[model samples]
Target: MILSYTNIAIKLALGLISLIIVINITGKGNLAPSSAIDAVQNYVLGGIIGGVIYNNNISILQYLVILMIWICLVLSMRWLKTNSSFFKVAIDGKPVVLISRGKLDTEACRTAGLTAHEVMFKLRSNGIYSIKTVKQAVLEQNGQLIIVKAGEENPRFPLITDGTIQLQALDSIDKTEEWLMEKLKEQDVENISDVFLAEYENGNLNLVKY
Candidate 1:
């Protein structure tokens, strides 16, 4: 009972601290998070938070020591990111180009740990539909694919359907609500609420009726 109570207290303290940190952070797109450094910072924060939770039989001094060490590591990395672009790249990694100049780089695909079918699927989801239409496809470090078309006009892409928001598809097409509502109305969807879902892309709107 004593141990359990102690555990609860430690967890409460850690949770409060971690929540404050997370609340202060800005939201970001999956590929490009608001702060580039947040990726590495989270891991260390997790460890410190974890140390507080596992307070079983460990002295408060020991926990403090570990927390201090983690803080040092985080500070060191932040210091390095300021002075060394090489270190920053090594930590965060660079975007891997899967397609370049209308050609698929098979070697880059392999190195990026993506199968040909997966690459094709990502491209298709992005509205490219054909590899020939893609000028460049970059696999960002955050595991999101970024595609750039060769043409001046960005082709309309479908991003929602069946009452479910397709996040991957939306990110690929950079879609918005205004565009979605217009597409829905174009398909004679008089009420957005009446429709179960709406999908748009390639100059078309696909809707699911309630």
Candidate 2:
């Protein structure tokens, strides 16, 4: 029993050390994810450690060897990405244009398996209050949207938030409650309670509901 505990403790210590070393080399990609590849690489590296750490048959030296191999493979892939364009493009796909020239590209949306509502939601989350403000929106390889708003566009933040009204936001945008209700009616939403979020920009009302 004591031998088993000692073996496990050693494994844990070695595993943690190996994990820290690998993560240090992997850089911010494994720490704070900016893309799907980063997240996947982080998991795959962790999965390697998980699979190897507790195996009784594998000696600590063997474990180190296995982990080092993985690190080398990851570094080789990184090197290829830097050295070869084809490898880079094949591994990381090019960005797709979802919206262009202030108009929704319905075909691109369909190709990306994204709904109009989702695109607008992402846009709104990025502080875009109206579709007209967007000159081009690119769907990044990591599934994030990169929106290029029209030049020197006005800022319009949320006025109605989750069934509650923000009177200050309304006044700043020069809109009235009656106008908001009319906009809601135009969208077939009956009451303010039905509205999840709403913003007005460039003579257009951007609304989202539960």
Candidate 3:
């Protein structure tokens, strides 16, 4: 009985240490996951550790091997998400535009799996009582609602993220691809893919290049 208890204690310590190491290696985002993948990884890691901690059949060596394999899989996925835009979108979907030009987009609401009441609730939580007062609203991948009120100092949504143009953002701002390309040219940016992030506010295109 004492030996069994000792083994459990050892397993608990190892599990805690493994979790901390993985979080540090991955990023603090795992602590408060902002994307579906991050949330899933956290849940799965917890489940794995919890499921194995009490099992006498699974030796410490086997447990460590399982953890190592899981860590490698997570790291590979993160690497792919970083290097490939398609994978990033596939893993963490792009933001959905819920409101544009002071109008509600029911289709977007449906796409986001949010009902009218839920949208209103979120807006109300943000101190927005009237939908008409909103100039633009986007539902982030993390389920947070980002609002740009009417007559505010420009909108806050990004024109480009991870080298891809956001068409919804452009539509919200009443801009076009041609206009964006022209602005990029004005800023001496020869290629769209060179930009890591681009935002338009107060009549200026701010760029972060890779």
Candidate 4:
């Protein structure tokens, strides 16, 4: 009985140590979820950490090896995201405009798989009493709701991201590619592929190049 208790204690300590190392490698950002990927990672890490502790068949050595492999994968993904915007969008997803021009965009809400009430709860949590008072509310990939309060600065939405045109964004604002091309021409950026990110804010177009 004493030997069994000692073994369990040893396993517990091993699990705790492995978890700490894994968390350090993954960084606290995984816990604070700045993207949908991070939020999913948090769930995955939670299950792995708990499983390592409770699963009797999982040896301490085996658990540590598994965690190390997972850490490598997460780190690799982060590195790739920094270098490739297309990969970033594929993994994290682009932020959706949930509320546009002081109106709830039900289509965007459906795309985000969140209800209007849920968005309202998030808004109220941010000290917003009424959704009507918002000019825009974007559902960030990290699950954050970015609000443009009424009478505040004009809401900015992505026009182009990672050299890809956001036709939906342009359609929502009643603009066309010809108009976008004209604006880009003014900026001396004649090609769409030259832009890394473009946002329409305050009735003006701001673009960044790769």
List TM-scores for all candidates, in order.
0.58, 0.61, 0.90, 0.62
lDDT accuracy of residue 161 in candidate 1? 39
* Whole-model lDDT per candidate: 0.63, 0.71, 0.86, 0.76
Measured over all alpha carbons after superposition, the RMSD of each candidate to the real structure, in angstroms, is 12.3, 15.8, 2.0, 4.7
lDDT of 3 by residue, 117-181 (tens): 99999999999998999988999999999998887766577888888898877876778999999
| Cα deviation of 108, candidate 1, in Å | 0.5
- Positional deviation of residue 168's Cα in model 3 after best superposition, in angstroms: 2.4
TM-score ranking of the models: 3, 4, 2, 1
After superposing candidate 3, which stretches have Cα over 4 Å from the reference?
A: 1-3
- Writing each residue's lDDT as its tens digit, candidate 1 over 1-210 gives 256776657665755554454444322223234345665566556766665665666665666566667556755765675456577667667668787657889999888889989998888887778778876677877777878686623433235533444443444455676776677677776665566655554656667787
What is the C-alpha lDDT profile of model 4 across 1-210, one tens digit per residue?
Answer: 123555467666765665576568756632577787776766776788766566677776787777777777777887778678778878878878887667888888988999878988999998998878976777878788877677664344588987888765675566799999999999999889899999988789988899
Give stretches of model 1 more than 4 Å off. Answer: 18-54, 153-210
How would you order the candidates by lDDT, starting with the best?
3, 4, 2, 1
User: Of the pair 2 and 3, which is ahead by lDDT?
Assistant: 3
On the 0 to 100 scale, the lDDT of residue 89 in model 4 is 78
